[model samples]
Target: MVRRVGESVEARLDAERERIALWLPVALGAGIAAWFALPTRTHWIGLLLVLGAGALAGLLIGWQRRFGRAVVVGCAVMALGLLLVWGRALWVSAPVLALPVVTEFSASVESVEPLPAKDQVRLIVRPLKRPDLPPRLRITAAGEQGKGIAPGEAIGLRARLMPPPTASLPGGYDFAQRAWFDRIGAVGTVLGDIGRAPGAGDGVQTLRARLSDHIHGQIDGSAGGIAAALVAGDRGAISEADEEAMRRSGLAHLLSISGLHVTAVVTFAMLIAMSLLALSRRLALAGYVLPLAAAVAALAGGGYTLLAGAEVPTLRSFIAALLVLIAFLLGREALTLRLVAAGALIVLIWRPESLAGPSFQLSFAAITAIVALHESRAMQRFMARREEPWVFRLGRGVAGLVITGLAVEVALAPIALFHFHKAGLYGALANVVAIPLTTFVIMPAEALALLFDSVGLGAPFWWVAEQALNGLIWLAHSVAEAPGAVATLPVFPPWGFGLAIFGGIWLLLWRTRWRWAGAVPLVLGMAVLLAQPRPDVLITGDGKHIAAAQPDGSYALLRERAGDYVRDAVAEAAGIDAPLAALTDLDHVACNRDFCRWTQDGRTILAARGRDRIEGADMAAACAAADVVISERWLPRECAGRWLTIDRDTLPQTGGLALYLGERPRAVTALGAGDEHMWRRPPQVSGNDEAVPTTSLAR
Candidate 1:
């Protein structure tokens, strides 16, 4: 019996070893491919680490019955590996920290978005980071500096061009985190008024603007015109309603020149080229013409896509399109899967952090799912029934739509919940209708608009395009505003994110029988996310109204001249909104009283300090015998005395103050709290009032 058991265990181990051997090479190849394609600041180390990790994972998982243990260990190892990758990401994406010396630089204004306030406009300035002059510096025109610049003007920029800022809000959308992966730093804006009219040439800027104008004129403010803008990656013309509708319907990706948009455009253009070439007499010429046409289309899309902020998915799609065309030109057999792997390997090597981002994860997952779906028996059955009947075709089309929708939806669902805390309930339906409209009607119209603009016949085309855009907008709005359009979800943990990713991977890889395993993580991720708690306090006000508590549990606000806005903001931030009225009920104007008095019914009284002249003397008297005296204004005049002045700026105009009353109630100690540790007293106060009494009885 013991010998039989030993043999069984050994057999299982051998089988596991065989499985590992089969998969290890593929994993290494993928990793090695990625290492080569990605750009690394510390090149050799990153390459070595990736290969070594791949090898380690392969060796560790070589035993068959140890699948569960191997998976657990592999996950732990990957988590550690990711930490190292993140560190490298930080170094490579170093933001420009120092200020730039602006000697001289010139750039033509591309476009501007006017902010709600008339005085400001968000200018997307393309400053020549490197100039002929020695004093010229690379500066980004983001945040405060990026505002108020206009198009067609060459304004000088003199400022620091540092790397992007770190994510300010923890667990929120980190623009800095994404920007670093993309190698974008802050660009400085013009220091003065527009100096010269930007010299015009027939570049992308000219073409894009002309095309946009022509479309606007053709559609005459129609929903279709806006749709054209969206399809062409020109979002400047889309109204707030259109934006809101797209967001709610989860079809905003259609307008964003992402993977779906780029792939659709490229695929359609390729099909047209292939069709035209197939009818040609010369086989050689036909082959060349088809590839050339596809190349031109890719370039066209690339130009527009870049102008519309080319994100990871758009870049990926463009690269994939070019690769496919190249493969055809080379007379290569259908090798799309290999090409996709190559692309992923290449992109991952360059930006390893990208693997962790929403764009890369969702796009790749969707593509993988599509590939797997096509390989399934369902797809084969549909292909066989193509010649059977119209009903078959109809059923197949619907199935295809459903399959594609489900794949993409599953891929992006995790990201959507994480970033927006909401899921588009009708997303599948919206994608089915809106995507076709944008791809076929809208994109083609945009291309025509560009031609019309070049020939100075832009207005007519713009008018016609606008009408179509309006119609699309109307449809989108109707769909988006429908009841149960979106549902909210709670935030998830890092582990939950991991589960979601694994779910996607499992669904994409497993043939059919074990594919159901993907749902385990998907469901778990959703469950984890929905269980998070909402923030109770929300603060929105200027600095002086209310000071935040320091590590030592003390808060400070301006004592002398406080406003209702500040008070309201503080109350909201502190999650004291419910008790706000009660705090005021005891004739207390502000909660920053020296002494706090509370009754059984939840009423609170703030006793006024001797030096501070509060709103109501009678109310102050009522709360005189208080549990604790928290100084609202400033540090006490005397540290060891009972006389407390709540006015800040009394000592020095530092910031705010916090006082922790010890066992000796009369012993006053000042806790300086604010941006700086300077004592500030209220300006309008007498010296005597501000002075501390040597000794005082319990009044």
Candidate 2:
């Protein structure tokens, strides 16, 4: 029996040997993710020890066969990943604004972005005279204050600045985290006239801005905006409604200047370069075809990546494209799985923090799944079109494109739910139309229009591009509005999401019959997610906005005056449409001048809207009787509720709170309990669980 088991184990190991390298990146990403999820950073000494031990073990085990060597290598890669992000976090750690400040200072503009709806321009500026402030400040200027401001200009202004905002609620997006990665410490609004300052800025930004403006000039309205977003990654002109529609239709990926756009640019550049060079008889005979074409493709992709601000998605896409071209130049068929893993490793090494973001997760997941699918024996055989009629070949191509789109959507669904609380189910159908239209018609026409515009004949092509964009927009909106187009879930446990990801990767990457075992965890994870109990009460981080569930299968907004952004976030988290009904007219709850009482299933919640209300209430009795008590003001020690109490003291500690009312009550926080991410706090705040004193948001 022992010998039989040993042989079985060896068989499994041998089967997976070929995939050992592909799993290295997965291990590395796991380490990086583990680091980010921790509430506190590991001690430097411990981190160093792990890194050293893993590396040494990896080297010593190289002579060992199969399983043992693979284990050591994976551990070594994971350690490397952990070390890379740990070092990065320490290196980039800097002070963030602790409080709001209003001051005057001169700054060198780092970048300029315009918002068309508000006629406002935004700038990332380095404050010359205010080193005490955050080094990078995002400032909004409107009207004459921002008129004609270019990227490299030095400007002066007085503005009121505040720390980058944290997540509005538990499980919502972390804006501050993103700002931290971008090195933006403060966000503000220009309060007065903008004046010329002492220095100039880089010209690369200026060039990008010019290109965006040129495209916007050619197309009109949101269609023009889509054109610009595709070509130069300028999404400023795209309206919120159109953007939302894009998200709902699953076509939002097209708008992001990621894999599709970069690949198209590289392919076009190579083919055009080769064809143009082939026209020259001498050059054709010289047989420099592939080399020169590959070079041009590289230049084009790299230039476009830089011009698109070289953001994570664009850079990642460009890296993958460059790898493929290099493989072509080396006369080897690039293995898709290896290419993806290599690209991921490079990007993670450079920007380890991106592993936590949706862009990185979604982009890589879609690619890995698609590659695995096509690499399958069944798909390879099904897609083979040799000796087939032209009509049959065309049909197969169309069917394959549609099938690929559906596969991508399936792969991306869980991730989208984890990040955005929603996923578009119809993106595959929409993409069958949208992707081909964008790839074959719109982009090509736009390029031709730009080329012809140089010689004063761009109008006809521009018109063709405009019409195609209009159709694309119409398709997105139409598909988005279709019944059951999107799948949504309320906030799910992150652990479940992690399990889902692991299971998915396992099923996709492994060739063994045991790959079917992945389905167990995949289903279990999604079940855990869908079965999570809904929060009865939702509170914003600032303690100014609140949401409560009503008995009639609906939610009520306590603070009726919250902005659209806040409302939308809360709504998404609750798995409902935004602009929730105000609590004022709700019939399910009883309200008095001092407090509101919501009761269901023999449990009660007492919430105060203002300090006056809290002062007037009988909190000791209320706290004892009620399942949960909530207020913005500090609650007395004696006023603890039966289950939970969230006030200024605890609210600030947690950032935001979600109360689940039931037989055994529980609470979830926006940053999770004891979260101490450096970007999430100010310089002097303690990272401990003890509450920090803070004032309630002023009425």
Candidate 1 TM-score, true structure as reference: 0.62
lDDT of 1 by residue, 223-257 (tens): 53355446545565566656768777877766556
In angstroms, the error of model 2 at 326 is 0.9
Report the Cα lDDT for residue 451, model 2. 90
Instruction: Give each model's whole-structure lDDT.
Output: 0.49, 0.81
Error of 2 at 22 (Å): 0.6
Kindly report which residue stretches of model 2 are placed more than 4 angstroms away from their true locations once superposed. Answer: 1-7, 42-62, 198-205, 611-624, 636-638, 681-699
What is the overall TM-score of model 2 with all chains considered together? 0.93
- Count the clashes in each prediction: 51, 1
Q: Of the candidates shown, which would achieve the greatest lDDT relative to the real structure?
A: 2
